[model samples]
Target: MNLWTVQTLVPLPVLVPLFAAGLALALHRHERAQRFISVAALSVAVAAAAGLVVAAHDGPVVNDLGGWAAPVGVNLVADPLAALMLLISSIMLLCVLLYSMAQGIADGDGRTVPAARGAEELRRTLQAQDADADESGRRDVLPVAIFHPTFLILAAGVADAFLAGDLFNLYVGFEILLAASYVLLTLGGTSERIRAGSVYVVVALLSSIVFLLAVGLVYAATGTVNMAQLAERLPDIDPGVRLGIQTMLLLAFGIKAAIFPLSAWLPDSYPTAPAPVTAVFAGLLTKVGVYAILRTQTMLFPHDEKLEAVLLVLALATMLVGILGAVAQDDVKRLLSFTLVSHIGYMIFGVALATEASTAAAIFYVVHHITVQTALFLVVGLIERRAGTTSLERLGGLATMAPGLAVLFFVPAMNLAGIPPLSGFLGKVGLLEAGVVDGSVLAWILVVGSVVTSLLTLYAVIRAWNKAFWQPCPDERSLPARAPIPLGMIGPTAALVAVGVSLTVLAGPLWKYAERAAVMVMDGSTYVEAVFPDGAPRGTGESNEVQDETEGSTP
Candidate 1:
């Protein structure tokens, strides 16, 4: 219960990986040393995030840095939503690490010889060096060295974003993650990856700049950048000033979230990264933007009708347009990337509704989507590895050769399509039910859009399944003998699929926690109170009314 104890515990999730990142970088020359440091750091972070979730199950836990009170010094706040996000992000980091290990092994085995002849000599030279390094007892370490430190740093940044209590600190955390992502996205420096990474970096930097401008405006207007303080003072601000700040912040976050029109960069950039990196990015980055939206809507401008409507329209457009893009894609990664964009609509719909049930549904969907989407992407990666390419034209008959991979892809694909008895279906049901209870035309539109999008997603998944798994392998006579899949690669993919299945099995408890998280987020007063024990109070206003209606209608 000591306040100082909280600070020590609070920063561990962020610090562990950061420390590991430094160690990994220093030991970059020794691959084994770097991998050990990276994995150890992530293991500790996962444990810490789990502990934080347990501690915050009942309420928020606030830690003031350097023993200074809020408004004067930084604070780290852990609410249920933040804890849940941290836990999911940590799980994703673990998967990415495993996948990286697997890919490294494959690449090291001379399996990754570039399709072009020009690179074949480079590959042979590298393989020769690898053999020499192995003779020197350093062979295993060379394949996946950069992955450890880069991924550890990425995890640290995500944890920082989840724990951040101030607007400026959140911005800083985002930049940290963004910088790490730039490296990961362009890691091999392939032409496709470099082009994609360039777009991603430029778009992300622009969004950060806009976010900084908004932060500056908020500070200038309110005299403080602490989220708790901003929440308290937001209601008292001039309507015009509040609107301007809200618009600027939303635009920045919207781009990051890939909401509707601002989403063009995502599909183009995400598909070019390595599979594990793509999976982690699919799971974590956009959610950070959604998290920002959730924070802004509930805490900063709770009762803005115009803003809510705009969000509603954007959600609809995003759902429709993204799925259409998914359906049109021929490559597995590109298809999944568009699907990722489409699902952002579901989260936006929940936020636009701004009711407890809808918010709870949003939280549930976020968790479920992260697991399901990451699993599917990894499965696609596995498919690419087994079949020699991710394009539908090159990938076929996987179901016969790799039944395990097929099952892994199918479960999440079904769940993502919102099929019955899955977490995705349950989440969509919750959103639709919330829409009905709200009794608004916008809510009804969202409900309809949800159903349509679900069906379209099913079509996209079925298309991929038919072309990649069910159909006969094209040029079967010319196909090379299938290479052995590394146990390390399969392990992480299996773990992610297991997590998705577990989500379906434990939907009840998970949904309950999600509801609690939604309530906590909607009622920002508790968060503010946790952060600033002596700060001026903030009103819950319409949020309380929405919560009451939701509770009254709950079965």
Candidate 2:
């Protein structure tokens, strides 16, 4: 694609939602209009992202925003990796939007679906007893008006981060999402949400402050904030200064990615949000942080052994500590939350390896985890909506009472636990294989940690399932008669589950794409070339990036 075309398509994913968010805010009184607007905007974004993905297979396509070229103006790049992320993100957004719209319709009025007349009374009684809980998710619920607009903005921010080629714009992307997330995280104004939102906001602000400082430092050091220029200049700077820059930048990104020691905020904050809110946040937000880490690690400091070693240790700790927390949790949402932290370790493992194959494995796992995690959370939301609690002690007989919900939950739950013949299993296997290829002691330790983590994940998930689904309910009130999850909700949730399966079915070709993306990411020159076509900086001599590409050719 030509630069003009690329410019139009590359920005559309971020721009379309931004414009639609305005419209959504304007049309706040008209629920149908806002819903239709959201669906249409995201549909257009998905098409744009899909096109970009197809185009990027040839090489990256770059756009100079505002018609100004590098170091002076913003740049948007649709490299293979960015394009792939954007495509999956768009798809996930649409599905979740569908699910949210369905949920709003159902819970907007507090009437029970065709149940025994007494069941309605019981619901009302339960509503009276748990007034705060009802208010938290059902009464005074987050309006579609605000939810749609903020969600659109959040989606745009994610897209921008993936496409951004400048640090300032990247910072802007993070802020855009962070602002929206603050609102989304505290949607119901419940005490738990307020508490969690406060923690989230505080953590987010610190990260942003550090991020801003890092950007200023980079500009001060290199005379530019453009990533390509930084790539060029960083090599010429003193090793100490470069390392300092890398340290600040990674520390900032690490908190955002929720890497261990920096991850204390995630499990506490995420579980309190409403289901759709939590699902999207879980699926996309930290991954954005991981994406930043992946970009800066490979692009700015290519292969710093010390940093890699540090990340390896962090990865191991994250895996063990996160899953152990999951095992200790009684709440499914919180269990999943800790698992979210744990799984990030897998991606970091790929990153620490700093090889094309390992990077490819990480990328593939990222996609798989995004789908499976979101789907599982959506299922969790369904459980809450149907059974009225996510506490395993309160939830049971779901297998017999809500068989469809059981199936929906089972598929993704197993996928997430890395059960055989599922995408999650395949993704983990790829990561493990890459670790084996590395054959270093640290790599072997991580591989072992990963396996143990997966087995524990399965055990935790199964334990929850057996308690929530297979076992008989402790009381009749735990489940109402014939409570059906609406088709609107089921369809969207099922769509994501289908996507999880697709990863397994298309694992071969997608793995190749990830390998190609890994090659591009490792070879910083490809990125620099795309951003600055006139002339781009090459790493001093032939680096591992070049060697990896050379070896990538051998196979």
Q: Mind giving the per-residue lDDT tens digits that candidate 1 earns over 1-555? A: 454554456788888998889888778776567666777888888887887787888888888778787777888888999989989888888877867765665656422221211123335546665675655575654434466777888898888888889999999999998999998888655688799999999999999999999999988777788888888887777889999999999999999899999999999898877777888899889998998899888887886889999999999999999999999999888899999999999999999999999999999999999899999888877776676577787778889989988898999999999999999999999989998998889889888998999999999999999998998878965554344567778899889988988998999999999999989889998888788777653333455467788989999
* Distance from true location, Cα of 395 in model 2, Å: 0.9
TM-score of each: 0.91, 0.90
Model 2 agreement with the true structure over 139-235: per-residue lDDT tens digits: 4322334888898999999999999998989999999999999988887555787999999999999999999999988877766788887788888
Prediction-by-prediction clash tally = 0, 0
Cα lDDT, model 2, residue 147: 81
What's the C-alpha lDDT at position 500 in model 2? 92
Q: What TM-score does prediction 2 earn?
A: 0.90
- Measured on C-alpha atoms, candidate 1 has an lDDT of 0.83
How far residue 364's Cα lies from its native spot in candidate 1, in Å, is 0.6
Model 1 misplacement above 4 A: 1-7, 109-144, 477-482, 537-555
